[model samples]
Target chain A: MYLLRRGDPTMFETFWRGPIGESATLVIPGYQTMSYFSDVGNLCWFLEPGFEREVRRLHSLVGNAAVEGYHVLVGTGSSQLFQAALYALALPTANAPVSVVSTTPFYSMYPPLTDFLNSGLYRWAGDANAFDGDDYIEVICSPNNPDGSIREAVLKSKSGKDIHDLAYYWPQYTPITHMLAHDIMLFTVSKCTGHAGTRIGWALVKDKEVAQKMSKFMEQSTIGVSKDAQLRAAKVLGAVTDGYEHQLAAAAGGDANLLFHYARRKMAHRWCALRAAVAASGIFSLPNEVAGFCTFTKDTVTSNPAFAWLRCEKQEVEDLESFLRENKIITRSGTKFGADQKVVRISMVDTDEAFGIFVNRLATIK
Target chain B: MYLLRRGDPTMFETFWRGPIGESATLVIPGYQTMSYFSDVGNLCWFLEPGFEREVRRLHSLVGNAAVEGYHVLVGTGSSQLFQAALYALALPTANAPVSVVSTTPFYSMYPPLTDFLNSGLYRWAGDANAFDGDDYIEVICSPNNPDGSIREAVLKSKSGKDIHDLAYYWPQYTPITHMLAHDIMLFTVSKCTGHAGTRIGWALVKDKEVAQKMSKFMEQSTIGVSKDAQLRAAKVLGAVTDGYEHQLAAAAGGDANLLFHYARRKMAHRWCALRAAVAASGIFSLPNEVAGFCTFTKDTVTSNPAFAWLRCEKQEVEDLESFLRENKIITRSGTKFGADQKVVRISMVDTDEAFGIFVNRLATIK
Candidate 1:
């Protein structure tokens, strides 16, 4: 019998196949324990009653009343939610041409995701100011990726609809009050909790109709989110809230200034280290280092150019990528981020040891 | 500030809002130790070198070939793979009228999923026998759900493009050797490994062009499957393969005869009990007692209604569902499975004690 190519079997028929008495089991024991339920992990839609109650209780700890009525839709991560939201809004309508707009040099995934969804149908329209409110949807990622720049826009949809994407409104980088109180907000646990593997995020939407439609689309697309991931996220969130409460109470009662003082001093030290490192690495340049990431350009002094703008030559970016792989360190070239070459992004979120190694590598590159 | 309607948030803009930090933190601890890689759990397109090696090893045990050159794609589940397949194949073309054909009472998810994809241009053609090769894609699920039936025609795509969806070719089931030789197959760990919560599934396609296009679609659709979920699946599959080897070794060493005899006796005893219970309960009539499920109909004897044939003008099935629920017995209504209202599916895989309880409850139904 000839062996078939991989991924060719029918799914609907395969699911009911009797337990293959094969020696190999396909899932880990812990995962197996939680696989039966629908909402146990970070990729969940339903919140435990207790978890929901606690979240409401801590509402005052974050932003203001602009968030009212906007409930959270958790996903595998914000990435999943981001793509889902884009698909939901891009449903074809004859009255207007559907377009996606975002700030230039925005999150790298946006254009690819848009292209993937749009295929050849719709195109990305950069610049929030250019939207005519007749045929476009705008995406705004604040405390943005790469540069960590936030753009405040009074965005309106083609049909005079107002939409907002407040993905990075966290207390760590900026004051909580600075959050854009728009109709929708997206956030992820990976960034705040430093649990990138969890792959969990949420969309806070104020409109019931849009939420229902999105839910339907999700159900039709990926079914509901993973139950196990959601439960785990809920448990983690509960623990953090408890920690925050304990810290706040201690501060209020004057029992310990150590907790707050240590946090402040640690932030100061990290910032100072980053500043000094940038200065020492003559090949790097950055506008500021206030947020999670810093964007840098090649200093032009090095014999090896930082980036080769490839769009003009009409060659794929992979050839340049091969050149970078020869070097020990890895950097995301500008093409992936939908930018012209002559620019590259470097992330400073690594651990002190790892960050030190990266800085050292950069220093030697020149 | 005015509160926006519940659903009208900016589609792509919601990611900026910080997640409910405390809630997310509560759920992270449970899955930290778990591996998230497995072909059956999610798509395998993003497998790392180490995990890829392991997956290949497991596939070799099953007598399947390694996935290379072709783009391996992952989905939220095998269900998503099914949707994606339909999307790719049903996209409009000049000669093709964009039609989908499936056997009657097919995998219940097909109709809903197809509609949900809403390629307004494509429509479902229910009769496979009359399917014209020109503009239609036929979906065939083997070891089919509801009725564990396999089809021969599904081995070849109607248009000769290639048969897709190979979910149930494991060792325990009657393998369709011809189908595996060339058709596209989709498989998931949900059934095989009982890890449904991870929501991972893979599709195998013989054609490289189809594979590449699907990969691009996946990247656009959900970026990629959850990395954490994929890793866990990989670990679990390794253990399962080991278990299969041990079982085979025991069988060969003449140490498993006693265990096999015990299992045979146990199955015989359960069937006997089930037969006795059915004789005692006149309200239901079963199609056959041998299959994975005992299908019931409301019309069995004169003046005795087999639950499968019992009809209500509006919502009598729901009434029956409530009646069963009051007994603390849970069984899916046929309506949910794309069957007639008079039919209800009763899984025979429950423990003998649970079956006894179910029998006792049925005795009380009349």
Candidate 2:
């Protein structure tokens, strides 16, 4: 008898739906009232009318060069658009062995989503070192998830056909225009607008057929992103662009300058704090800052943990996870991100206060 | 050369992303006032603590039922849940062939959604006039769309498997409990709480494996319905149920009595108007009144002779549709519904003023 299962019943179930019964609410220091839904919604509105208008205006401000066709189809959040693109392009045909190719240590969700969509029919070909055209479809996320490494332009696909997920190509990180030359460009309001809940994203595609197919797939898949979210996002995008323009107009000082100044100071403070904490413990080591995350390895002097710990083996990381969970501090293990058990990922997306709390907690780990 | 296509250039463009462009601003009447984002956000709260508290209170009021191992999974709208169930239950690998079986003259979206999901991979196995489980998945919608006929017991497979879609089983229509004894029970808030914009619906299944599979598919497909939408739906559901109970207490009447009273009164008014119109024409024939919609054939004669007094032929129905469009009225032609082209479906789901306008417009056809 085939007894049906209820829940995902897997170690990665949280990724499937997030901590089911836990309070994920957190209070950011400077940002008192942070609603992911509102932030994301504000970003969405710009994609509709306001953003489109701004893009046209930007073109005029820059030069007479036409904006690439691949830079248009924006969405509720990049996540929503990414899923739609997968459905639209990935057809489950015997002749067309649908395969997804992505560089290792990329955005964590890619492999799982690919697996879920595959339904055991297709699988992810995770070998960036030896990626080939036989993979059919390739997903590349620049300024990748954990390490935040941006692929240089020289690393183009051998077949010259690939879906470039430029999800993190904000002006602050990489030149946004540089990534627009790809056949598909994915951008999300979550990382840019700092609104993880609004769930809005977009894909700019040069191919009309691909765009139409993706749209159709989206319609069939989720029936489009929430209209309210999209409209709100458009509004936020307009406000941000306006702010950017005002900064540009200011003579000696502007919003852009102020933003850069603030970001630099904040990054320096956090980096120092992180460095001090790691050095004092002498148990964990981290590479230089990449994108929004810092990768860490365990120290050799420490007892070899079972899981992905600097000093411990793979099993120690799991034990450490249990220890952290008991203290209400949740950290993602490297295994979840398709990395060696010795490595763990920490997001720097949190505010100073939260980061401080996290740093302090880790400092006590020694 | 590979040409890149962008945007949807097809007739059945996906409608799941909420309305786009000018239509985005158009509020769906009665169902929801806030934009889709707000609705989704509100609905997502249901999955939160405060909202779950309310849900528990409501469950207590309704008495303890066996809800173990079954948790609610929401969708963009009931339309999405309907499609999800089809995807979950349909055999991925069938030997002879697999078909979707629905009663003739059922919810119109079923065939189209099935076709869209199938993408020419599978086809609907016409009405289950003969209950043969040799090659089909039987789909039955009680209190059906278009006709609104309530089926007491749907036809089951040879092995006793059944899929029941109870899209409309509110106190306003019929006293009904979801037929959970079946393999799957599909329900939606669009018809019940009237929150179409929330786009929240759920499927009740006895099989855990099926539920998990469907949930996994949905996570990758749409990444779980908008959290905001689910919470709002929970709020509406709680309030609506309370309102129904209060209304029932004030009237000192049971749900069936109230439902019968409203249904009979509305049916009488529409039937009277329709009968009078047909009597005056002396050449129109009407179907027996069983549900909210009725089919009528044109056979009237008039002296002005602009009356293209004709039989219900395929070409004539097409011509009538063009006529209606010209007058700024829209409707589903019989051809689209798999009905005889000579007969057109006239819906009573509109307001009285709209119905009056329709009557006046029909009078002009003479």
Candidate 3:
């Protein structure tokens, strides 16, 4: 069993622990909240007007990305959109399964989700840089998950299409260096607003036809995301964006900044604390921190990533996961992210108490 | 364009309409609802204790199905479960695309959803009975959508698996015929509680492995259904089951009867009114209504189908949908439901005002 299950609140709590109140929580009436679908667009079933408005509003408020000339498609979460991206990129008419690759030490779910059902449309061909392919789809997870490293499309080729998973690109997760303009970029409410329970995410697609196809895949797959969840997500986004638009924080009346500023502060604190704990542990190592000028935050800032990628230098800890498990520090094996056994990923987003316990345990590692 | 959108409330509005209140509405506490996943069982992310309890309670109270030995898997909606079923049923090792066949005049979305991605894992092979194949999957939509016909597995093959889409099998839509003990049976809150906006559905599977695979399909598909919607669904279901268990109607103490009884009365009235209008027209024909002794209601009950399947006898109507469109009586084209153009399906459960308009227009069909 994964070591995370031993805690009272557990390691999963580390992720998405920000405060959300009445402004974020939505109560849908028992009666019809809205029509099952959008009437004006080709999008089928329940693109709640409030949801669309708030999503567009949030993007504009952050100024981290551009929405114009793009088709915004909502999904169950970024995970489904990732699948939809694969479906949209894969040529249905092709005779052979399209090759799919990501960088080494990449996110693990990509390989399995890409190949599940052994669907003949796409196959997971590992290591984007190592592959000698003219025809393929490359996935680039920016401000990477296990490690807080910014990335760009690694396999630059004419025959390849890129799916940029900007899940970690929000100001809190990483420095929003510039407006992310890509063919397909994915964002999720779970990470940005800390409402993972809502299970809402969206893709900003440059090509309208590709966006339509991706939405069609959602229609065929789940008949679109839940209306209740969408409305709730809309409220959450609105709450965050309201801070910027209405300048709720500038009035200096509240204990917390707007959701964005609040997240930025909390993440910075945790990242700093985590770095100290690792520094205190001479046996462990983390990547050197880097910062970029974030247009949204208007400062040069480093990422406060969701997971801490740690590499063990000692031979006594051959498998970092086993070593962490023995120490009661829950973690995911680094190889799960396509790296070696010397490395493991630990959740830093856990409850502050849990993270303290995690850091204390790390500090004691002699 | 489809004819259904012409009505005041529209055709899509017919599916879910009920008087639900704050008791049924869910306010998801922003605190950790559960870990992003469950630590135990094959089910990964969510198994809301309330969701599973309420699902089984509702099913048992209605006496339409058995969940005693089944694994109840929740989904975003039955439409999503439909795709998951396709994924779980298709042989990953098979050399050829697994043929997925359903009866003619079937639910329209079946064929389109099956072929939407044009995935090589499964291909839509029309008409179950006509296709003589040992290697295929047959979908039996008991009290089928669009046409509202009660059906069974048309093709009995040792090599073929059956997916019983019982979306329309609720006491409101049809009689509680028997303990529907199918291997894989699907039910939805959209039909049962008239909350299509919630987008919650569950599958009761006899085989644990198949259930696990279906759940995995959900995990990889949408990363599980929305937790907020699931909690709300549990509340809706709990309310209905409470009415049934307490025998709300016997005491005459509640505002509404058990959801089943309330739906039964409303649907029967609409179906009777619809038949009278069709009879008055003299240019349209409808399938005869069949009744059976319902164990749950303990009476000989007739079907009050969610839709009215109409066949145009007059030669003037080359395409029945166009004729209806001209009359402002909205309907789905028969060809769209995998049938001939002469037939059309009308939503019987449209709003009182809209259904009245539909019946009035039908009376003038000559």
**Model 3: per-residue Cα lDDT over A1-366, one tens digit each:** 234421122332322244435445566655544334554554534467788788788888777778887778888889989988888889988989899988877887898888775766788999898899789999998888778788888887798999998887788777777887899999987777666666889888998778877887887777677888887778767867765655644565542536666667777887888778877988888888877888886888877777678899887888988888888777878888788999987766656676777787888797
Candidate 3: which pairs clash? A14-A349, A14-A350, A36-A46, A37-A46
Q: Candidate 3's residue-wise lDDT over B1-366, tens digit each?
A: 223531112232322244434446567644444345533454634666679989998888878899898888889889888888888889888988899998988888888888866666788999886898799989999898777788988888798999999988887778787899999999887777766667789999998778888988888777777887887788878867766666654666543636666667777887888788878999989988888888877889888787778899998778988888787766788888789989987766556776777787788778
Better of 2 and 3 by DockQ: 3
Off by over 4 Å in 3: A1-20, A38-45, A244-250, A253-255, A316-318, B1-20, B32-35, B38-44, B245-250, B253-255, B315-318, B326-330
For candidate 2, lDDT tens digit of each residue in B118-183? Answer: 332235666666446655667777666544565644564463335677655433343333323456
- Residue A362 CA error for candidate 1 (Å)? 5.1
How big is the positional error of residue B114 in model 1, measured in Å on the Cα after superposition?
3.4
- Residue B168 of model 1, lDDT score: 47
How close is every model to the real structure, measured as TM-score? 0.66, 0.65, 0.91
Best by lDDT: 3
DockQ of each: 0.15, 0.12, 0.45
**Model 1 lDDT tens row, B150-181:** 55454244453434455544433323233244
The full ranking of all candidates by DockQ, starting with the best, is: 3, 1, 2
lDDT of 3: 0.76
Question: Deviation in angstroms for A263 in model 3?
Answer: 2.7
